[model samples]
Target: MSQTRFGNQIKQATLTPFEKEVIDGCLLGDGTLTKSGKEYRLRIEHALKDREYVSWKFEKLKRLCISDVQYVSNHDSTRFGTVGHPEITVLRQKWYRPVKQVPEDLVLTPIMLAIWFMDDGTKHRDTVDISVHSFSEQSLHLLQKQVSLLGIKTTVNSDGKGKRLYILKKSYPSFKRLTKPYILKCMERKLP
Candidate 1:
């Protein structure tokens, strides 16, 4: 009753390259990897106003899910998550060690950046900020370096407790160039 290809057994759902990027981006913000028995799943939640954004994610990931997007009136929020999979469990190991943390070799693409921005980015006038407050300065430095790979210069700023990756106004043009196309219209408020 199992599946095989070219005499090789095919495991349960594996993430496509694009889906991996989407997961990475989401993990940078609202996404969490939760253990479900032997596997782990990717879960996301957003305020009601961001339902369109959740729908966008669901459309990309529905192949892994059975439930439609849910509207929980009690919390007034929209939410969805993929079914448990071993691939997600592997990601959980890398992303969460007791507490969530960025992986050591986190490479990023433009679209991934867009996804991260949509989930957590805040527009401040002509500039933007990726609110990664749960991370330490060293971890923010790691992310700051990854964004630099896109040629957008960012500074890591701290507010006594945690750090934020501040994309400078001068670099907003470049940042916008990479993330604008993938940013959903529903999340356009995050852009200037």
Candidate 2:
């Protein structure tokens, strides 16, 4: 997953002359103006679109690799990110139930937990504050349970119509703490 290699590979791929000129112009930060430049600009846009398509292709490849590793290692596979559905499945496999139960102590990092709140349609703030529409008593109880697991204390307010708001007691986790590098290091190593 080296950017340099990826860049070289892209360079090696056949490209229209217009695309090459546009890419060159873009790299030089030269605004396109001439007739060929305009065409180059269009080609650049096309290249960008193609790049996005390629990125998606790579993502699928990575997922497949992860899945294969999981299968060989007999580990669980958990998928995160807003771009895809959330699920935990058997390693190297399409969605399947785990042979072993996930532990209750296995809490999501703060950043990952944030997704749950967002999915519930709550607005979160930097000040550890969250606002949400009315909740059912069951929903409120569930929210409290999850918050407790995250070691976060929350103060709740109700508007008497089941409407509730909660303020988090701690700072949001820093991006560095939630980054992939840190997370991968923390995860149990896959069996070789």
Candidate 3:
């Protein structure tokens, strides 16, 4: 059905449980919640080489999208950070508003953690690195505490990129056990 059919059919359907967790993770990662005029959308863009991953996410979110996901080649002016790989865009939903700070409504779950890890977490020799430099120190600290509530200890550190968060080596096993089941096969390499 077309997105124009927003009468009763569309209103009847809301984000499924899995979709909710994925959106939570997307928000914590590179995905952006933005607006066009009055409508808000969740925008996710990834390199073309990761087309399969993008496609998988699209499949999971197709019900909320206005149109099919498209792979668009980015020119020099449009390159995000690096160039060469074409990018795919998966935009869906019209109710997600951009937040100035971390939202209290977010209930971080294991699946959400896995998605965020696949998106921005890095595996290091002795610790697990999570790139949260885009967030403020206060936000990072809050996140660290939130993770700690799950019994996983985390620390915030500063780098050239700003503030980054890390799951201590001692917490790696707990973190792994929490998020491993939800991680996608393609992103397995990101885990310890």
Candidate 4:
């Protein structure tokens, strides 16, 4: 059967406020919205060391999933000389679009920023780097604008790979104040 046709069995549902906050943050970070033909799915994966974190996310999203979250052991004997850490995937065929072009109706909150930082943000010496290299220049600009609306300033830079958004030094205090409360204890390292 076609993936789109098969996947259509799962209906799209509206997200609750809390769900929207968390999932939107996730999408801004490592969460991906993918399509196969006409099927759109949300995919989230994390290393086994983050089992608890992923499990926590699974719990928050399980109601919308067509199947249970699956745990898989990742192996790269050639590269790392041994089977590597485990990981988990929480996949669901939902109708949400990608975060690059955020929906107007969806609200962006500090909690979402915190979650996104947990996913793709790294603490630099005096600035925070949001790994948005996978996004296009236009998308990165949109993200910057969105963040700017929160009173934080961001600049886009291109490394060898792609473009990334840097939370400027001046924005450090605002960024820390906004995302601190939402950061989990395990993800404290992401904080500036």
Count of clashing pairs, candidate 4: 0
Q: lDDT of each model, Cα atoms only?
A: 0.82, 0.31, 0.64, 0.63
Pick by TM-score: 2 or 3, better one: 3
Model 1 lDDT at residue 129: 86
Tens digits of lDDT, candidate 3, 1-192 = 554564234334655678767776877787766544343456677776666667667777666665555657662111111101111112233212233445555567887777777778888786678888677665676677778887898878876877667889999999999987877787777766
- List pairs with backbone clashes in candidate 1: none
Q: Which prediction has more favorable lDDT, 1 or 3?
A: 1
Please provide, for model 4 over 1-192, each residue's C-alpha lDDT reduced to its tens digit, 9 standing for 90 to 100.
653443343344444678656767777777765553344445678776666667667677665554555666563111101001011112222213333544444455898888878888788788787888666565566677788989999888776767667899999899989988767778777666
* Model 4 regions more than 4 Å off: 1-13, 34-39, 66-69, 75-107
Q: Model 1, range 28-141, lDDT digits (tens) per residue?
A: 888998766577889989999999999999998877775689998999999997777777788899888768888888898998899988887888768998888877556687
Q: In model 3, how large is the Cα lDDT of residue 8? A: 31
Clashes of each: 0, 1, 0, 0
- What are the models' TM-scores? 0.90, 0.29, 0.79, 0.71
Q: Where does candidate 3 stray beyond 4 Å?
A: 6-12, 75-99
